[model samples]
Target chain A: MRVLGIDPGLTRCGLGVVDGRPGRAGMVAVGVIRTPSDRDTGERLLYLEDNLTTWVRRFEPDVVAIERVFADVNVASVMTTAHATAIALLVAAKAGVPVAFHTPTEVKAAVTGDGRAGKAQVTQMVTSILKLTEQPRPADAADALALAICHTWRGGTEIRYAAAAARAGGPR
Target chain B: MRVLGIDPGLTRCGLGVVDGRPGRAGMVAVGVIRTPSDRDTGERLLYLEDNLTTWVRRFEPDVVAIERVFADVNVASVMTTAHATAIALLVAAKAGVPVAFHTPTEVKAAVTGDGRAGKAQVTQMVTSILKLTEQPRPADAADALALAICHTWRGGTEIRYAAAAARAGGPR
Candidate 1:
């Protein structure tokens, strides 16, 4: 299965693509989507949507993995984040691709053998797992890879009714 | 002064534009940015960035207003929410527009004279204040307008430290 992983952020988002077969694993693409700081928030979000839509169409990965929201404060912030996630989910559904969501702890545990792994640890493991010559830049990119890896290890185990889930939910 | 308010989200973002003048009340232009629900979190963000950039170019507002995040216990959800706000901030910074943030409560208070105003109350006030012929569609758009109104009122009292704050924060 070809899997795409995403580390979500407003300013920076890390994305990684891996081709996983029954016993063979390979890397496809890994990079970050950055929103310039001087644009309007609405424009930034549209940027994310535009770039991601293009990426999905170009890569056509079988599945997409995303990190789950981990906290509850900043109600305004939460709403925005949810919007971001909702956009991602919407894209995947549009492409007829399945999506898997993993918690930060689960991604850390899978990537670094600890649920509490630090950013550095997660980055290190992601680089090593992909056998890259250098560590991924901006940390978020590697984290995206880790989320993808976690999904590869646990794909299709969790069933999601995304469209139904979204309709019922108020916030993004 | 022209203040642009944004209610950032993954699926739909609320955008409100208010024209502020010395010794005169402002007016509002409110709308929502809607993205398909099938996109993944990353692509959704990219969409947000692109559209928001377009909005800025078209409107050329003097200032931007955004809601601060409200935290929650669901870590997976919180991360996505944070990303949305972060991306929005990045867009404002890139555009060289001054940005201000407000809490939901603060926005409610400014719009409805009650910090605990319901969504309907806030929406009604937004319509009345803007002298709109109809209620803004999709609550996000109205909320974005309210944030803009709040920021206009609050930002007026704020020391205009655009250069210093920009340099200190850089582009998000």
Candidate 2:
């Protein structure tokens, strides 16, 4: 299965696409969608939406995996991130792509075999797993790829709950 | 001038349109957009977007006025509302329409001459201002019309700040 993973944010939205089954996945693409904070908020959101729509159309992934957010000290920033995530979810649904969400811990555990793995450990595992000569630049890009890798390994089981629930219950 | 007012929510999004200035404004239209809780969150958002797009096209208001959200005990609900508001603002931006936000206190004060006005008093004032024989059914419908009226009366000065800020920088 092809999976498009997103680490959604207003200013820097991480994106990655992976193809193949668990443990045999190959990286298709990895990048981030950045919006200038100086622009209008509506324009920033529109930028994210328009570009994300372009990505989904171009990659045409079978599933979309988004990193789940719990809380943050900056409520304003969290709201923006939440709105970005909502836009991503809506885009996936409009394209009929199944959507799943994985918490930061779950992603770390799936990739590094430790729920509490720090950014360095996660980055190391992602580079080795993807067989990349160097770590992906700008942490967000690496995080997006890590999300895709995590989903490839653990998404099938988690999909039975998160994805299914979202498709049925309208976004809890 | 024409104004479109929005009281955004996940379950019921209230909308109304008015034309003319301050005390002479006349109601153009009013209604609510409802989304079933059973649908997926993505689908719900898509549904809202499509319907709202239709409303904006049909109304063709000069300015869009949306209720500003503050701290709510229900973070989840607030997030959904903020997302809805974001969608509205983005839609306005996409259409090149001016958009503004008004707090609940401002709306109440503009409509009833008191920031702490009770719901009934606001409803009464809205009925009188719109020259409606009876108050609009369902609190949301009335609230929407009140928002439209509030903008007509108080939006001019507010727009210099809110609308200008949004058009130049982004949604606030």
Candidate 3:
């Protein structure tokens, strides 16, 4: 299965694609879609939307996994993050890509065997999982890859297979 | 100038379109866009996006005004509201229409001369301002009209005009 994992943000949205199945996934691509912070909110959102659509078209992933943004006291930051996450969800739907969301804790637990795993530990696990010679550049990029790894081990293939069956003739 | 005001919500998004400026604005249309709460989040968002886009295309508003959602204790609710608001903003940007946001307090102050005006008061003031014989149907719809009135008085036309000139040759 090919999976695209998204770490949503306005200024820098991380995207990573992994190929293969559970316990044998390999990194296909890892990067971020960035927008200038100085841009208007609407314009920035449009940019992100455009790029996400482009990425989905280019990758043709079987499934899309996104890190869900939680409500928090830092309302301003959370709002922006929520907006970006919304864009991601909207993009996936438009592209006819079935998408699922994993919480930060869920992702950490799946990737590093600890719900409270630190960033370094998570990144290290991601590197080991993908057997990459070096860590994915930038923390966000590594985090995106980790999300892909987590999804694979945590039922992404089953979800995609189920979605495919639904599309074919089974109950949704 | 024509203005479309949006009060964003996942289940009940309020939309109002008005004609004319500041002291002379009148309602052209007002209604609520609702989606079943039981629908999946992506489907609900898609419904709001489709309705908002349809409204803008039909009305061809000169500007779009949306309530600026703030961070609150209800994180889940706020995030959903923010997502709907993002869809509104993105639709306006895509249509090449300038968009403005009025805070709840700002909308109340502009409509009723009191920032802390209650919903009924704001609705009453909106009815008075729009010279409507009766209050706009639902409270959400009334709040949307109030946002339109606030935008008209608060220089939506001036902002649009300035944006036009900037696109023509003036500084942005």
TM-scores of chain B alone in all candidate structures, in the order given: 0.84, 0.88, 0.90
Poorest 10 consecutive residues of model 1 chain A by lDDT? A156-165
Residues B1-172, candidate 3: write the lDDT tens digits.
8889999998799999988766789999999999878876777777888999999999999889999977765778899998998888888888989888889999999989999999989999899888999999799999999988888888755767888999899876
Considering every candidate listed, which one attains the maximal DockQ? 3
**In candidate 2, which residue pairs clash?**
A39-B169, A40-B169, A40-B170, A41-B170, A41-B171, A170-B39, A170-B40, A170-B41, A171-B41
Compared with the true structure, what per-residue lDDT tens digits does model 1 show for residues A11-116? 8878899886422356789888887668656566667867888889989998888888744555655565565666676567667777888999998998788999
**Model 3 misses residue A70 by how many Å?**
1.4
Candidate 2, residue A163: CA error in Å? 17
- The whole-model lDDT of each prediction reads 0.75, 0.84, 0.87
Q: Give all TM-scores, in the order shown.
A: 0.59, 0.87, 0.90
Runs of candidate 1 with Cα error greater than 4 angstroms are: A1-20, A24-66, A72-100, A104-172, B38-47, B73-83, B131-138, B159-172
Residues B1-172 of candidate 1 have per-residue lDDT tens digits of 7888988776778898988632234564667877667865556766777888898888998988887765644565555556666666767767888778888999999878899999999999988877788888789988988888787677665534554577789542
Q: What does candidate 2's lDDT look like per residue over A1-172, in tens digits?
A: 7889899998899898988666767889988899988988778888888899999999999889998886444677777887798789778878998888899998999889999999998889888898888888677888888888888888655555677788898563
Compare candidates 1 and 2 on TM-score and give the better one: 2
Q: Rank the candidates by TM-score, best first.
A: 3, 2, 1
Displacement of the residue A73 alpha carbon in candidate 1, Å: 10
Candidate 2: DockQ?
A: 0.49
| Model 3 lDDT at residue A104 | 90
